[model samples]
Target: MSPFCRKVRLSLAEKRIECELVEVRYWERDPDFLRRNPAGKVPVLKMDGKLMAESSAICEWIEETCPEPALMPATPDARVEVRRLVQWFDDKFHSEVTSNLLYERVNKKLMKSGYPESRNIKAGAQKIKFHLDYMSWLLDHRRWLAGNTMTLADFAAAAHLSALDYISDVDWNRSENVRDWYAKIKSRPAFRSILADVVPGFPPPAHYADLDF
Candidate 1:
């Protein structure tokens, strides 16, 4: 699955919002898929007989409707911090790292788009070091990505990283804090389904689902 789709999936898992997983290849731009989201994104969430597009908006709606076991901070200021980090991973990290590595290596072959570009793959591999260090630094001081409590920020970052992990791109030994943080999150019930993700012709590394890793 795409990182964007995984982000929404993680939120649903965390909130215990039972939903069906319907895989859609947005690149094909199927007519029915386009109707759900004019943008033709994979993560079009349907609940209570209504359709919702966009990851950020759907996540916020989930937070509002399912308040228990909150994924957002109670204070406005803290929530502002969470949003900032969420965007940081979703936009910045996705562009620099994910597009470079995962898209180049995985999406290309899956969609028969073209041969994977070497330059983008190399760039993604190099840039992931910086992002991992950033995560390590954040974990050193805070209990989670945004703050002390687990929030949407953590799920957002994890969603992208986990996709990379599926392809065995992440260097878990880069930082103890980051690795430990991942281990903790990885063991959660919310993370179980993610570990089970399988993409045809691209088998996951053994460590992808290993909690000890």
Candidate 2:
């Protein structure tokens, strides 16, 4: 239903975990979905008869359920770093980028509103450069965001970034390291389904599905 869901889907795929995708039209206020998750979020995961809401919780559940191809570091400090990065991407990046850009440009039209707000668009456009530069700095210092291993943090970050990228809000040329990291993740088997996603009137940029881009 949203990019957060797609991020979980990608992580599950990367781990080779089998699960079913049930799209919930959250705004519709379906009684059953609301009962399952009072928050009415799109990514309510049902696995082994247990329900889980919230993207971070769902991701942690997946990591625990399927630990093989681990997405979290073993060391305590490293794990903390991973969690910190995940929070940065899901929270800070979301506030600065996703909410301002994707919501304005795509979500507004999807919800049948007027045009994108110029102020919000401009702010989002300006803020993304700082985030990209931050990503570039991290990539320059470490093999991955949290460490050498690709962790849940990567997926969380990618989820938001990919969503914005789909709407052509991301300027890939801002940072080569970030661009390369995205290319590596984009080329993964887990990313295929996300790349293929069609958002009605919001057709993706040609390079959205192109791994080389």
Give the TM-scores of the predictions, in the order they appear: 0.98, 0.95
lDDT of 2: 0.85
Candidate that scores best on lDDT: 1
* Tens-digit lDDT string for candidate 2 (67-131): 88898888899999998998998889888888889989887787776788999999999999999
Q: Can you tell me which runs of candidate 2 are displaced by over 4 Å? A: none
| Model 2 lDDT, residue 135, Cα | 88
Model 2's TM-score against the true structure? 0.95
For model 1, residues 4-109, the per-residue Cα lDDT tens digits are 7888888899878777898888899989989999998778998989999989999999999988789999999999999999999999999999999999999999
lDDT of each: 0.91, 0.85
- Point out the worst 10-residue segment of candidate 1 by lDDT: 15-24
In model 1, the Cα lDDT at residue 177 comes to 90
What TM-score does candidate 1 get on C-alpha atoms?
0.98
